[model samples]
Target: MAVVKISERGSFRKEYIRWWKHPEKDIQLFDWLDENERERKTLFSPGYLRDRRNPLPYGLTKMECGLRAAAALFAGDPQRGQDYAANPRRFSMSVHDHIRSLRFKYRRFNSKIGAKVSNMAYVDIQGPLLQKIDQLMLVECPEWIRLHFHWRTDPYYNQYWPKDQPTAREKPVQANAPERQLRKSSPGLVNQKRALQASAVRVRDGQNKANSPVMELPTPRENSNSGTTQVRSSSTTQEIETLASEGGHASVIHGGATNLDGSITSIQRLELLIQLRKLDIEREDKKYAAELQRAQVEAANRHQSEKHEIMKQLADYVTGGKGSTGGSSTGRDE
Candidate 1:
């Protein structure tokens, strides 16, 4: 530690003694007094601090005492400032204490001088002071001096310390191991075997219905007995057959018909022949009607033309007879 003998006549110690007597004389003095009162209240209060030991030395103001106490805590000895540089914490704390004591005392003496010293003090002590205090408490501290004093015994220190309690990786039991195994299996294997068997039975029943002889009927024959060829009564197959026969007759009337699937049924093929014959008869009837109308119109026009020709011939014949008789009478008169 470097032995820095701060004399009673030094600027810092002198200003501190002066302000201690008259606290309200300067604004800085008043501020230090209020800060000292608050700090004392905190240290003496029941809920604030567990230990009530005064950390400051005797014969010093609160600010000066606090600086000296910090130096003594980190320094080699409180009586002599020696062997301080050997320990980084001690050296840092001593420097911080000297600077802070000087700053407060200077503020009490001269405001302008205090401001300049404070700026320089921030540059030198701010980073080192925080680092040293944080190491002492084994936690992080704030950068600002006011905050450092405000929360001197940090509650966040124990909270941020690495806890000894176990984490999730340390636990043995897993909550979702069974669910994870279920997800890894195929969906087909996951479903019950009984359900798959029931589905297969239903599909087989459908194929049997499609291939059964009861659903397929024999083709119609021209020479076969019509009674035997007719569908059996009291059967769903019979009803379908009757509907098919009716559809055949509709196709005969309309010339063509189709089933729901757009394919021509057996009934539609039989009806198509009948429809072609009906269409031929209808075409002959239309041709006869048209020919009759044309003949009627031609006969009426020929009759009118003949009547006009007969009237012109009668007028010419009568004029010729009259001219011939007049010429013969003129010859007899001559």
Candidate 2:
């Protein structure tokens, strides 16, 4: 930590207090406060935690202590500052200490500034800390800073500490582990899993329906009884429509017994309808061709008859004969 002169301490403390008391303070401070509140809830909640066992902590981690000290210094809490300065080691507890000790011992160490120093000198560390916090408040907040971002991973915070210094709140990275540790499942993968499960259930239900027995249908006959034919046809049509609406496939229909009505499923009925339509189209085409051929033959015969009649009239005029007889027979009348 950088040391500041005695004369500047008062101004730094005043600036710190002003920043804390400002109505429109930095958004990062609010975010940090919210994160602290959430962390406190998680730590004290009656739930299973991977790193922590006891609901109540015996000592505060370094990160926790730094947050507390910052809040105290900003709030102008003299009693909290005095308490922390007197027992620095108690708040600056190592996480490894509890991990190593089966009985969870919380051992305290001597303060670096020495206990013999005056109260004002011991609290002088606040000047530099307050200046650093003020400087940090001016910079833009990074998106990655959250409940998991610790002093060990923060380059700005770690600049003052030694390279090999261990953070009590952060666990050491394992050699085989990835750079970033994920504590929660990805939301996208969870949604995909749920969709797959739902689709599987729908498929299972479809299969069960296909395996069940179907009701028998009335058979249609080619007899001249119009009423009987109409009844059977209507019943079969209704049953086919119901099956079609249910979205039954060919495979599903085939699984049912073929009864007197040919056990024809809705899909089979549609296929038959298509075939019948094709046959009707073919019949109409053949009928049209036959009519066209008859019209063409009649036209050719009429043309030949007219040509013959005209030839006969021209030959009679050239021979000067009335009808087929010579003209001498009508001389007396002339």
Candidate 3:
């Protein structure tokens, strides 16, 4: 394993205190601090780290760390960051640790200049970081900074601000919400909802009406307003609506009696169908009767013709007509 090149400020401070306590004038302090102990500090950790890939160590270089951070921020989603961190093939946790360690190192390094170890030098790393942030296209920089963060006032941010959006604007008032509330609270809408609920209830009750015994309802007397009906069922509502829409107050209650009338209509239709079938049957029977009478007449005529033919043959034999044996004998005597 590569030996760690960095350490926490406390350890560096301890080493600095040790070096201070010792007196070997020939031993160089540069060699003591650098070759012996390299100095660094950052916001994320006051602890030490080993050989890493940050440019300022900061990353494989500033570019790689910036790329990773940019992708995390630009996607604006937690899952995107998770996916990047979870992938080992393309990522190095050591590299992430390096950037994390050096991200705000400049401020700490500046603090260290007048303190115990003045050897830990400052490096301006935020410029490259800001460049990466711009490349990632975040509208604004992240806001959480307890240390020195001068990048927000940088020239690039100032130039980019007015070029894309010139001025800060007032929050626009929402005008449509009150209208929506008014529509929802409208009297007509409430009545329509109630009517629909009633229709649904009627339909559900109608489904099992056969099992429920029907109670006797008062007979509905015919009124001049009989074109309309009060809502006994969904069908009755439709009838009332039709009458009311036509500019009439005509109202009536369709009772159970209407059901009998409907059945009677159906029975009448069946009777008509039966009468049509009977007419066809009677016509067929008459045709058969005509054919039978014609056949009987033809048989009678055929029998009479055969009887006449037999009688003529007997008469011819008795009278001794020509070609008979008596007729030939008489001719010979003549």
Best-fitting candidate, scored by TM-score:
2
Off by over 4 Å in 3: 1-264, 320-328, 331-334
TM agreement with the true structure for every prediction: 0.21, 0.22, 0.20
> What is candidate 3's lDDT per residue for 1-334, written digit by digit as tens?
1111234675441111111111111022111221211121111222323433444422243334334433433234343344444443233333344334333443233232211111110112123332322222111111112112221222121222223432211122232342233223222323333433443455457755333211111122445443442332335334433433443321221111113334211112222222333344556768989999999999999999998998998988777654687777888999
Model 2, stretches more than 4 Å misplaced?
Answer: 1-262, 321-334
CA RMSD per model (angstroms): 51.5, 38.2, 42.5
lDDT of 1 by residue, 143-242 (tens): 1222222222322211221246432223222324322332222122113233333433554578653443222322323554656534321242343334
Output the number of the lDDT-best candidate: 1
Residue 278 error, candidate 2, Å: 0.9
TM-score-better candidate, 2 vs 3: 2
Q: Which residue pairs in model 1 clash with each other?
A: 1-82, 1-83, 1-84
What C-alpha lDDT do the candidate models reach, one value each?
A: 0.34, 0.33, 0.31
Q: Rank the candidates by TM-score, best first.
A: 2, 1, 3
Clashes of 2: 0
